[model samples]
Target: MGTEGGHGHAIDTSIPSAARMYDWLLGGELNFEADRKACEDLLEIAPSSRELALNNRWFLERVVRFLARERGITQFVDHGSGLPTRPNVHQVAQEVHQGARVAYIDIDPIVIAHGRTSLEVNSGTRFIEASMTDTGRIVEQASKGGFIDFGRPVAALYVSVIHCLKDREEPAAMIRRMREHLAPGSYLVICQLVSDEERVRREVTELMDQGTDGHWGRVREKHDVRRYFDGLSVLAPYLGDVTHWRPDSDLRRPQKSLEWVEFGGVARIR
Candidate 1:
């Protein structure tokens, strides 16, 4: 973490970060030139990269809205939260349930820096900086925050973040730990970048790894993502491309490649 001097926080421009790259993909100005260049290179290989980002964001909004409005779930925990983008989880949930409380968690210093500035003031929102691997610590901190009551059904979101984990960390195990903490009838929303085309996966993974100085994770196979939902009961539509999973019509669009897209689904703890 390289400091910009005032916020006592470091903004490292030397290594490209996924959050920054995502900001670039979404046309935000919070990223460095390295992030932009990496996004461009990724686009050259995966032309639909930007669209994929938008689609995934849409999925997040829809899931939050559903939990708040339809299911009467007022507590949300967003893990691996990226930069503070428009219509974030808190915004969407609060619209449906004004008293909805949300806790945003992320390991990146940039996320924490921006979160403190943007989210800390909201009465029902708070941001905590921590790695996804520290599920116990995350749960403990969130429990102390008073916004999220683990004793009740809480929505735990892992949207578009699991791919950041390597096999050694056992992303599935992390999910299981969170599940063990949630009350029955809770919800789990997950999605990860996936592709059936090996060449597409290899090229995108290699290019991103190089450009970001190995900060990115491998693009997984579709089935591998589905397996993450093993213990939970999947919602009616089961898992598929992120764009196709109960997507809003306005956000629905055709795919540019037959290779793959972000894939996963929502499930309930039965």
Candidate 2:
């Protein structure tokens, strides 16, 4: 197993991490007690959190398969890739094309540790510990590591993670930076928590911000997320609820959460 943490920071169980909380939501055992408790509190605010997480994960897999099988993309960069889960980006892409290469990027130490162990034997995959905003460094490292070729069409996936960025982070600008780095015809997969109800957006955002110690971003409206794909060619159905984005028959039963939903879609860089 290969595991490397950029800062070598020890895991702190005192603070709740979004990644660990997400793990808890997915019924994964890689989370700490703090994460579990935090998720419990989160569930109180957004009762459908677990359903949202599962649907978003399925959307990620579907898009990756589409890019690999339909678009013939051979390389992928999964930004903010959380703790290793079944049917990871590489696993989904490789199923379509065995030679496909994937680079998983995340700032969570636990994710890096667990990712390295899970991907160690896979020569075509790599786990990088870094902020997704560090597009240049991530692209450079993935290129230098020889797992991802920037010259070819690459799928840059922000899937369900952009909500971790604060307003000052300029998430849209971050997407633009990545788009500038990718080759033409490359794809960008994005989805984040959104709500039409002002109360749901405000309350959920506040709850997550406090629980994660301000490491959370506000739940945005549909229009705000739309700006992230400006000038790019969005895939069919445009931007809407992720649950309906090319759903498979095996998809879990939809959760009745009119409060909020995971929304966004894949777009091709022109």
Candidate 3:
């Protein structure tokens, strides 16, 4: 990602990237004015956008720790892994299982740019700037990169990003392809924006669809999300608002947005 950790690329600050926007929402300093404006617009629609991001992130950290410490997963392939934030996948996993290896996937140039310095923190990490839909490419790169092992259980994290795939893109189908490539006992951790309110779904979907400044999908219902786990052996505390997907502690941040939530859970491939 980003020319192997050296040389800077020209980033078009006029456009807003979802990764940058997310980093901004998390109170990070990796965003531009366009991203800030986009977040403001998003907040106008979903007032609890920041809280929702925080909750999803907390869920991600908690689930990774569980997988590494309890479930014994060491390798990870983060689909659409966004910009580097505090306690990333590798950092969290390594804390539980030292020498945990991770392959970060993202097509965003911004993410690619930052990943060179931020993600490649050790020999245990790698970054691939490719479509998450390209499971074959992901596997090949991860295997050839000499970090991730396909023969071992790998946690493929979709965490909060599937809403970027349009209906015709078939998010569920992409997951099935991932299952085909991954070893059994490997985990598929997924969660994305979902809402029961018809208005929230429509408006938020439309807003993100038009202004994400890149490929984007609609906010769907819970039923639509369940389709992604149709054949997988879902883990305990199964599919629901990720805010409640194993709280890990009562100290977690609260997301008051009933209008929309990051919904889905972890499932294992048999």
Model 3 lowest lDDT segment of ten: 1-10
Return the TM-score for candidate 1, rounded to 2 decimals. 0.93
- Model 3 residue 219 CA deviation (Å) reads 0.8
lDDT for model 3: 0.83
Deviation of model 2 at 225, angstroms: 0.3
RMSD of 3: 3.5
Question: What TM-score quantifies how close candidate 2 is to the native fold?
Answer: 0.94
Question: Which candidate ranks first by TM-score, i.e. highest?
Answer: 2
Q: Across residues 1-270, which tens digit of lDDT does each residue of candidate 3 receive?
A: 011111124477776667888888999998899889988988998899999999888998999999999999999998888888888989999998888999999877778978878778688899987888778888999899467778878899998888888788888999989888788899999888888899888887777656654357778899999999997899889989888887875677788757789889999888
lDDT of 1 by residue, 193-258 (tens): 888889888998787667656556678898788788997899968888767776666746666665
lDDT of 2 by residue, 1-270 (tens): 011112235677777788888888888898788889888887887888898888778788888988899999989998888888898888998999998888989877778778889985798898877888888889889999566777778899888888888889899999999988899889999888888989888888787788666778888999999999999899998899988988777857786775788889989987
Sort by lDDT, best first: 3, 2, 1
Global lDDT of model 1: 0.80
Among residues 3 or more apart in sequence or in different chains, the pairs in candidate 2 whose N, CA or C atoms overlap within 3 Å are: none
Candidate 3 ranges with C-alpha deviation above 4 Å = 1-10
TM-score of each: 0.93, 0.94, 0.94
